[model samples]
Target: MIDSFLTSYKIILASNSPRRKQFLTDLKIPFEVKTANIDEVYPDHLVKGEITDYLAKLKAAPLEKDLKDNQILITSDTIVWHNDTALGKPVNEAEAFSMLSNLSGTNHQVISSVCLTTKKQQLVESVTTEVTFKDLTPEEINYYIANYQPFDKAGAYGIQEWIGYIGITSIAGSYNNVVGLPTAKFYELLKKLV
Candidate 1:
């Protein structure tokens, strides 16, 4: 496995997301977790992938400075883009419902950017997935918010949750990106590091 191949270096993942951690686990890449509170603000002019790439690297900047040559740090960010607007994590139930309502029967892009940093080299990349939802009813959106409490998710919903099972009509790219991380693209990037 990659454990032997990467024996010379230690991998550190700078995220607390269970989904992101699970991705590294499922990929069989050995890594340690480290996190810092970063203000995820980006310039207003940055759109979709740019926003994510900037944020991902922004999340990495603080943690990357002290990294040892034998350590590689991975950081990432995701956002839901619809109608030329970015829908981040909802602040409350009403906001969650409102975000979902706008996404109903519409196509939105799920953009995720992953940044890998070492003391000597750095790389950042992104993947965007298009998702379409069936016309959602007020009742359905209300039920999802009340039961699932999607306040932590962007676009006010988790694609791997009940909403995805019942509401998502189709997806045109990596579902993993929508869930949290872009596993395949991330793996390809990791290969580049080696």
Candidate 2:
């Protein structure tokens, strides 16, 4: 399907995320990774998807001037929203523990935004997945923090890791969205853009 839509276009993924790289590889769409040092900051007034959407677009801004006629650039951002607040990647061990403790026995939304840019046009879209967690004991949380060191993941967890295996109770949307990318929506948009 991608071959039909993406023919003759050079696809570029402007992110350092292994999950995003793997997603494109899994789709058999050839792409190159080119990331810029962009500050992932958004205004306090931006809410929910706006935050991620803005960041995703921010990531692609550096590559806009460098894009060739047929080159397509993709950038993305994922954040966890719990209790009307966004839980970004933990800055330290204590923060990771606190974030996990807060997420325990509760439901949260994982929102991922993707920006697709070309010289002629740009598109930004996002997906939200609801994830519920089983009540986690302090020992379990400690064990995960000590072993997994989830400082790089939003909500201090990875849905494909050991913590997810035991802590997650259920999910209401795309599991891949929680992992980092929403492959279904990503593919649909890629098909249209390519």
Per-prediction TM-score: 0.97, 0.97
Q: Pairing residues by index, what is the TM-score of model 2?
A: 0.97
- Model 2 Cα lDDT, one tens digit per residue, 21-71: 998898888999998997789999988889899999999998889999989
C-alpha local distance difference test of each model:
0.92, 0.91
Candidate 1 regions exceeding 4 Å error are none
lDDT string, candidate 1, 93-134, tens digits = 989989999999999999999999999888999999999999
- Any residue pairs clashing in model 1, and if so which? none
Residue 87 CA error for candidate 2 (Å)?
0.9
